[model samples]
Target: MTSDATASPAGKIALVTGAARGLGVEISRQLAALGAHVIVAARDRRQAEGTAAALRAEGGSASAMKLDVTSEADRLAAREAIEAAHRRLDILINNAGILIDSPDGGTPAERQPSEARESDLRRTFEVNFFAPLRLTQTLLPLLRRSEAPRIVNVSSIRGSLTHLSDPTSPVYPIRALGYDTSKAALNAFTILIAEELRGTPFKINAVHPGWLRTGMGGDRADMSVEDGAHTAVRYATLGDDGPTGGFFFLDERLPW
Candidate 1:
């Protein structure tokens, strides 16, 4: 760890899961640049360290945490470490996700909604929905310690059931059953969590980070990694007056 302070000038402590590459890296960098001591956590320790080091190199306070969001051991270890080191957590960006089904919609037989493998759907939920929900639950103690705790669930437009039903929406045809439904579950989690913490200082919301050119987004995505991270970072750094239990893309409120 660096000799610098554990908390940033903003006096905020943030943990960003899947912080090794793409939007995760960009989100970490943005938060670190804003003087929030960012914990770059990923399944790969080395990659997380690299991200933390890069942030430090850019004159930001950061630390690396090896975290596989799906692992119970990792979730507990992260909570313990944060409690010991920072005592409180101000921000958490649940950004790790997977897209196992065909992005080209359910044109193919096996990839179709009716024929998609249950195993793949289950795995997607484990990573995209269950992992974040469980991790947040595990870290609730530390979050309660903060004056203002922000939880940003990095969701997708594909998760919008309204849009999914609308033939006019761009993603209406791009139905990856596993990926889409997993995010929908995440959205539900966000709403329920926020409802539970409504009068409190916690602000929890799901973010739709637009189509971006990342590993999951593929080469033809319309946005960049930086652009993809904007909404998540926005929700992560929201003020006490900000809205919660909502899905957002930039300033626009998305349909649940």
Candidate 2:
């Protein structure tokens, strides 16, 4: 952990996981554009480096780290690397996730809750819920060293418990059991940790970036990736007066 005296005077330092492409890369791009030294993290080193290289080509300050969010070794190594170079971390985006089952794939019976495999449930939670939780814990020390540390958990509207239970809600009819529940768990984490850090300059939020036309979201989804990246970027770069421990989509506060 770094002391306040050694904190970088440069722009923010941000690490975004699963940033090789899609929503992750978009978030990294926007953060880099905002003058943050964005760290593009992915399970594959080549892909992560490629994404970071592309960002540099666009004149953004960026780098790449090989990080499989699910691995403890990767998480600690990332913390060490960032601490060595930057001392403090201004932003941490827990963006790595999985949607093993989707509405667009498999037979309806295959995707149904009753037919869902235990392996699928565990895998989904491993990536979506547990990975971020553990990674955040590992990096908390570095984040605390910053003047205003922001943590954004890339969540989904499907995580809304109110929507899941309400038949009239837009998300009510849709069900990807494992994926949805995992996001819900992530949302819970955001609330809990935010409360624990309430008096500090930390702002932690679970943001839904809308139904993006990405690999996980599928082509039938409504929003563009550009628009989908907005909410997370907004929260990730929040002001001192910004709300924490909240679920959000754009400016709207979502229900638990």
Candidate with maximal TM-score: 1
lDDT of 1 by residue, 1-256 (tens): 1112122327699999999998999999999888899999999999999999999999999999999999999999999999999999999999999888865322322367987898999999999999999999999999999988899999998899999899998888777889889999999999999999999988899999898888878777888988888778788878756888999998889999
Cα lDDT of candidate 2 equals 0.87
> How far out, in Å, is residue 30 in model 2?
0.7
The parts of candidate 2 lying over 4 Å away from their true place are 1-10, 103-109
Which residue runs does candidate 1 get wrong by more than 4 Å?
Answer: 1-9, 103-110
Clashes of each: 0, 0
For residues 57-122, write the lDDT of model 2, one tens digit per residue: 999999999999999999999999998999989899999988877644121223677788899999
lDDT of 1: 0.88
